[model samples]
Target: MDDITRDLVTLRDYWRYAISRFNKADLSYGHGTSTAGDDAAFLLLDSLDLPIDALDPFLDARLLPSERKLLAERIETRVTTRKPSAYLTGRSYIQGVRFHVDERVIVPRSHIGEILFREYLGELGSSFLPDPMAVESAVDICTGSGCLAVLAAKFFPQAEVDAVDLSGDALEVAKLNLAEHEVEQQVSLHEGDLFAPLAGRTYDLIITNPPYVDHEALDGYPPEYRAEPRLAHDGGVDGLDLVRRILDEAAAHLNPGGGMICEIGSGREILEEEYPHLDFVWLETASSQDAVFWLSAEALGVE
Candidate 1:
């Protein structure tokens, strides 16, 4: 082992090293973290086989020689390959729930998961749906990694969830996560474009975090983003191509009082301009505002 590796005896030392490497490499984040320090913590804690949330207890703990070597290798891989930390760990969490992720699917990081767990439709109030438990069925379109689908099932235990994705490979990853969360019995996986596979099926609620990254933005995304599946990020010219189709067809698949919630990732302006006649209730989370919207069946002009 190198002298530098030997000197990384404490967890804090390794963490500092990881952060330095991440920053120097100019890595792009947002799969689960927004900064190099946060990403470094995840990678370092995961490499040590320690619970990521329980860092306070082990921050100064000393690392074994073998552990130090493993962490060094992982840090090197992180800097050299520029893969997202989630991909490096092969796992990700949404609202404390764990899911499997790989190149087959985009890393699961959506504010919709937070909104679902909160069980409160922001700005729309009770008129949208007074009680989340009343939702008998839900569908998660473009359900990459099935994180949102699993979250929906957990949030509304009585609701049966259908997770749809255009890529079969992504569905395979979702299936693993569904089983991991033990929601397979309640959540069904479908492989097809948007609502095509659903045919005559409708739901009490339909949620999606589709590919809303515009072509221009996608072209400029950092290497970390380029590592993910292209089909999961490209949203065409204005980033509203798929969103337009979804809005056009969502009303038909929604129950009378049902609603549609979606994450547009900064496409709110385009959405408002394109559908000026509709009233969209923009929802806010702790980290974001105006990135997600909810529209009731009535607002969507569906009976």
Candidate 2:
């Protein structure tokens, strides 16, 4: 073992080393983390079973010899495999809530998560939907890892949640998360193409973060992204194959006074140009602006 791995004495030492190794590898990020430093911190914390966000407080704390060995292997594995720290650690978090994750599903990093917790929870005073307690039914389509569905259930406790995903394997991962959150009673999992299995069912709220990456982007995905299942990110030639379907069919599946919030990454301009007649209300979050949109049943022409 190297001197650092053999003699490193503190979490701070491991933290700095992880950051350097990650940066040296030029590893691609985006699955819940955006930079080498962020990935390093998460990997170290998760491996040690410590609080993920409470790192600085523990940085100067001494590390056990076994902890040092574990961190060393993990830091090297991260650089060598280029796997997202979420997958490496078998966990991911959104809005302070943790979810079990794996290669079966894409890492949960939707901006809709912020809107659900911030705006819908009234931190920013949501203007699109009714109060959480007033909502009776909701759906999370393309519910990879079931992160958003869990968030929806937690944010709107009284509402019944339906989480749908096209990949049965992805649904398996979602199942773990739903159960982990103790929302199996509140959130139902369905394996099928979007809305196909929800026939004759309408929801008061809908939140979807579907596969919206264009073909060009998919073809060029770095190792980190390519590690995830293709079904979670492939949005077809123009990246709107499923989004178009949702826009076309959502009106019929929405109850009176209901609305849908969806994440489309970079499809804002194309969506605006293609569906100019529909009044789409773009939403902004702490890290994203206009990447998500809100559509109401009335605007969708509920029949």
Candidate 3:
């Protein structure tokens, strides 16, 4: 057990050492895939009543008995159980934003996080929505952890965000995250399949990172994904089962110039084949994640 005091240099070295060992040891079954080291570090910091930013300094110093015990137990758990660090700590970050996550809700790792962080989508359909507060009313359908809804509020300060999810458990996690960011007042939580609870309500923006993983792909999802709620990851046969339904009725829920932003996973190929005549701007992002489409109410045949 390395002594971890308030020394910055030593702390950073120790943290890196632990991270490297965890990575090499394959302590987590989901290791090499998720940020297991970060998870372990977070757990340690949390147990010591220390802040994450203080990690560099603490690792350089010698560890107190309590701290050593805490880390030892955590390391043992990680090495022996192959459990994901997020599940151990019960939280995750997306786009530098902290989001409360757990088995109830899938961890927030969507590529859309990059778009939101870059403010790309905010401008994509800006022409369609001329109102300065056009995004004042937005919906994050199939919102898990309410990360997207919270980001919408953060980006569009005036927006009243609605986050809907079919799973009560998922909603609970989303609620916690929303409240954590102190955006509870700016966001509303609804429990039901997409759009079921919206009724007559309409929004200027509808952003979603819905279940777009096809049944086949879903079945083969890594163990980490399997641990997440199926309702949050399964998108049916072609991966657009729910997406098609959302698009079919989405126009009705969008204000005249409003649009919906959706991440279609690998369904891009399917969407292109199915809606060749429709005009949807497929926004590109880092990596193979290339199926996000923005559609206006008009595009959906909504009058």
- The C-alpha lDDT values of all candidates are 0.87, 0.88, 0.72
Judged by whole-model lDDT over C-alpha atoms, candidate 1 comes out at 0.87
Tens-digit per-residue lDDT, 17-90, candidate 2 = 88888888899988777888888899999999998888899999988888898888888889899888888889
When 1 and 3 are scored with lDDT, the better candidate is 1
User: Mind giving the per-residue lDDT tens digits that candidate 3 earns over 167-223?
Assistant: 888888888888889998999999998999999998888888888887888777655
Evaluate residue 249 in candidate 1 and report its C-alpha lDDT on the 0 to 100 scale: 94
Top candidate on TM-score is: 2
Instruction: Enumerate residue pairs that collide in model 2.
Output: none
Compared with the true structure, what per-residue lDDT tens digits does model 1 show for residues 118-211? 6554555454443677989999999989999988887778899999999999999998988888999999999999999998998999999999
Off by over 4 Å in 3: 1-59, 120-132
The C-alpha TM-scores of every prediction are 0.94, 0.96, 0.82
Q: What's the C-alpha lDDT at position 56 in model 1?
A: 74
Model 1 stretches astray by more than 4 angstroms: 120-130
Q: RMSD of candidate 1 to the true fold?
A: 2.2
Going through the candidates in the order shown, the clash numbers are 0, 0, 13
- Number of the predicted model whose lDDT against the real structure is largest: 2
Worst 10-residue stretch by lDDT in candidate 3?
A: 2-11
Displacement of residue 58 (Cα, Å) in model 3 is 6.0
